[model samples]
Target: MPSTVTSHHRDIETDRHARTRITVTTTADATAVTVTGDLDLATSPRLRDRLDDELKLRPRALIIDLDAVGFCSSGGLSVLLEAVTNAHARGIPCAIIATQRAIIRPVKLLQLDRVLPLHSDRAEAETWLALVARLR
Candidate 1:
C-alpha cells in the first residue's frame, strides 16, 4: 500500500482571472495520484510538483485518477504531458482514469492517447495492469 502524501482542496486563480478549485491526493505506494476538482493554469503547478516528487520514487506505474476532475485547461494539459514524458524517459507506465469528456477530449485532441493509456475507471486501469503483467 502506498502512503498518503497529502490530500486537500485549494483555490487557484488563473491568468484568465478564473477561480478554480483543485483537490489532490497521493497514496503510500506513491504510485497513484488522484486529482479531483478543476485543473487549470493556476493549479497546474501543484500537479507538476506532485508528479515530480512521485517520479523520484520510481514506481513501476503512475496512476492519475481524473474521474472527478471538473475542468482542465492548457496548463493542466502541460502537467499531464510532463508526467507522460518523464514516464517514457524512465521506462515507467502512466495510467489515467477518466470518464468525463472534459478530461478525455483534450488528451484525444492532442493525440496523447498515443502516448499514455487512458482508462474509463480504476477497475479498467487495474485490468490493463493485469493484462500487461500476463504479457510480460
Candidate 2:
C-alpha cells in the first residue's frame, strides 16, 4: 500500500525565545521531521518528546532530516540516539539524515554514525525505509 500523508507541517514548533524550527510531517506509514537552526539542550527535549509521541502511534517508519541544522550539541545527539533506540525497541524503522557538517562532525568524531542509521540522501533513506518496512 502506498503511504498517505495525513498531515504535512502539522505544526511548526518554535518557541519565541528559541532558535530552532521543527516541521513534522506525518504519513500513514512514516513520519518525517525536518529541523532547522541550532539543536542544543534547550531545544532537544521538545524534539525528543515529539519523536516519542510519534513512536507511541507505531508508525511503520520514522525519518529525521537534520540537513538544515546549523549547530548540534551533545544534548541534541543524545536526543537523536535516544529516538532511534526507542523506535527500534518498538520495531519501528528509523532513519536520520545528517548531511551537514554540524551534525556530521560530532557524530563521526564520536563514531556514532555506525550505530545511528545515518543517511546523507533523503531519497535513499526513504527507499530503504520502504524496503525495510515491507520486509517486517
Candidate 3:
C-alpha cells in the first residue's frame, strides 16, 4: 500500500466552546491522525497521545490537518513541538494544514512556523508527505 491515509474532522459545540473531532483511518502500511477541537492545556494531552501512537506506526510522513481547530494554547504548542521533534528524529516528516487564523496565530506566536512546515492546502501537504516518505 502507498503511504497514504484517510483522516476525518468534525466539530462539536460545548458549553464553554466547541470541540473539534478527529478520526484517523490508516492501513498497516500507513499512518494517519486527525485532531479536532481547541488544543489547550486541557486538551493537549489527547493530541500528544495521538502523535505518540502515530510514531509507533513508523509512517513515512504524518499529516496533521488543523482546519477544524477552534483555538490553540501553549500546551497545544508543546505537543506540536514534541511531535515535530519526534518525527524529525525518526526521519519522518510532519505537515500541518492550517488555513484559519485561529489555528495559525498560536503557531506564529510560538514561532512554530520556523520549526515546522505549514501547508495552506491539502494538495501541497500530500505532495510534501510523499516527498518525506521517500526520504525515509
TM-score winner:
2
Residue range 84-132, candidate 2, lDDT tens digits:
9999999989999989999999999999988788888788788888888
Quote each prediction's TM-score.
0.74, 0.90, 0.78
Candidate 1 lDDT score at position 31? 61
Question: How much does candidate 1 score in TM-score?
Answer: 0.74
Clashing pairs in 1: 2-28, 2-29, 3-27, 3-28, 3-29
Two-way lDDT contest, 1 vs 2, winner = 2
Give the winner by TM-score: 1 or 2.
2
Q: What are the per-model numbers of colliding residue pairs? A: 5, 0, 2
**lDDT scores of the candidates, listed in order:** 0.71, 0.86, 0.72
Q: Identify the superior model by lDDT, candidate 1 or candidate 3.
A: 3
- Sort order, TM-score high to low: 2, 3, 1
What is the TM-score (0 to 1) of candidate 3?
0.78
Tell me the alpha-carbon RMSD of every candidate.
4.7, 1.8, 3.9
Clashing residue pairs in candidate 2 (N, C-alpha, C atoms within 3 angstroms): none
| Deviation (Å) of 110 in candidate 3 | 3.4
lDDT of 3: 0.72
